[model samples]
Target: MNSRTPRPPHGSSRAGPPPRPGRRTFGAVCAAVGALVLAAPGCGVLSPGSNGQTSDDITVTSTMIREGEAIPARFTCKGEGVSPPLRWSGLPDETESLAIIVDDPESVGGAAVHWVLYGLDPENPELPEGTVPQNGKQGQNSKEQAAYDPPCPSGDTAHEFRFTVYALKADIALPDGAPLDQALGAVASNTLARGRLIATGGR
Candidate 1:
């Protein structure tokens, strides 16, 4: 026998195989995959609404009408019309220019276009309550007028007028009185972002 002495054998305690290098590598790969999975979309890794928020999420208010304010009937008729005041926030910081379009979506044939205005200052947070200057350039509305046409919905049903504000990367090239389709097309090609507000009136 050699000089060294072996210890007493334990019950079925044979030596296991040495740790495998491949297993360690596989574990590392699995860890990386897990990290990527946790960082993907809907994983709460990104900011909420970073892609963009819906019109409902924006804070759109009018000085004339409170958050739940009811619109007056006088503004709905042909006489003594005052454009409602509007205020907005939460616009994307990259906005370069602003456009405003107001339309009656309840029109019988498709959504009707009411007011189309591009090239407003995006820096300005509000449109002073009232009709924009008549002399100001008018985009082609459904009636072919370039001004705010108050809703004169028939029957007792309330009609919603949607005011959409587009944030553009550059000023639209069309002249004052451009057609609705053309203006919208220009916006589609150049818009950096947009916002909207809605108010309802019935007669």
Candidate 2:
């Protein structure tokens, strides 16, 4: 009598052989590597609106507005919409350039970047009202405008605006009308010291 071939053990797949232990481990490693690769883009040295406060602080002030005080109407949308006069001191001796960033923290979508002025001469410790320093470059604000966009908070609640000055160790060479992120990144990376003057604004 002819004998029939015995069936394979249960749980054994006939379609293909079971995966080897080495292959399974390799697959797991590949999956882990893939996960790491996918997560790399979001891993940045600095988050938006953060300037890496790892160094000394400078003293920033304004002639027309005091810290924590309501900003003058001339500097807001309700009036002439001109930039406010600002001053700062305590710059490190190694500072080679200066930058200014004005923003409103209470904005709807993150901090509204009102103005980004970089490549200012370190020799000038103050900026006149409504003036861009000589040879300074302007960056796009939250409205995508290349010039200063005065703070205009919606609703009746007053919004606090930050006028930050960065003292950088190296001069930035960004072109005029650079993107806000690019200008901020350049300022933050080279910042040797910084200061802030907080003021409020409303409709």
Candidate 3:
């Protein structure tokens, strides 16, 4: 997808002023920010602080693809490039909201964030194919677009895409179109538990 990538139905156009030229690549942005992104204060590079939460604490599943399997082309840049369906359970009883971030940390250009989404309803455990939950909010991806930029890894080797979910103590109050860094920081801070469902995709 080019710069004109269309927003998913759940995406918002209200993100702050469009990203400045040359600031399109997330890796560049992280480098420019020094240790901010690396420290989990800005970028979603590090998973939210678990505060004792463990990956085995929650169970994330998806009918579109199995754990560690290759993501189907239908949900990648090779095909429709739509968001895949996801389901999760085992949230803490105190969980009040949820967040999901899909990213490729091994991207040649640095860690490329394909999607930044938050404010999901804690009670809702499933997201249908190509869609976000009704209450979910969309945060700008590394390209500064608030949509799913389907993975299109270069070369023959597949790229690992982390579909991580965070169970938060409360719903985030970020505005629609918030930057990825801001949204991720909020999610990380409020996270009560977290889990991941890894999948791969490539040319």
Among these predictions, the greatest lDDT belongs to: 3
Comparison by lDDT, 1 against 2, better one: 2
Which pairs of residues clash in candidate 1, taking residues 3 or more apart in a chain or in different chains? none
For residues 16-42, what per-residue lDDT tens digits would candidate 2 score against the true structure?
122223111212222322311101133
After superposing candidate 2, which stretches have Cα over 4 Å from the reference?
Answer: 1-53
Over all chains combined, what TM-score does candidate 2 have?
A: 0.72
Better candidate number, 1 or 2, judged by TM-score: 2
Candidate 2: clashing pairs of residues = none
Question: Which regions of candidate 1 deviate over 4 angstroms?
Answer: 1-58, 66-70, 131-136
Span of 10 residues, lowest total lDDT, candidate 2 = 8-17
RMSD of each: 30.0, 25.9, 8.0
Of the pair 2 and 3, which is ahead by TM-score?
3
Specify the poorest-scoring 10-residue window by lDDT in model 3. 1-10
Error of 3 at 87 (Å): 0.4
Per residue, candidate 1 scores C-alpha lDDT tens digits across 1-203 of 11224333121111212322311121222242231111123221111232343132335676666432345655555544555667777665556656776665554443455567766555566776554432224465555555555556556665666666666666677777775556655655565555556666665
Tell me each candidate's TM-score: 0.62, 0.72, 0.78
Q: After superposition, which runs of candidate 3 have C-alpha atoms over 4 Å from their true positions?
A: 1-23, 28-44, 48-56
Ranking by TM-score: 3, 2, 1
Q: What's the C-alpha lDDT at position 148 in model 3?
A: 77
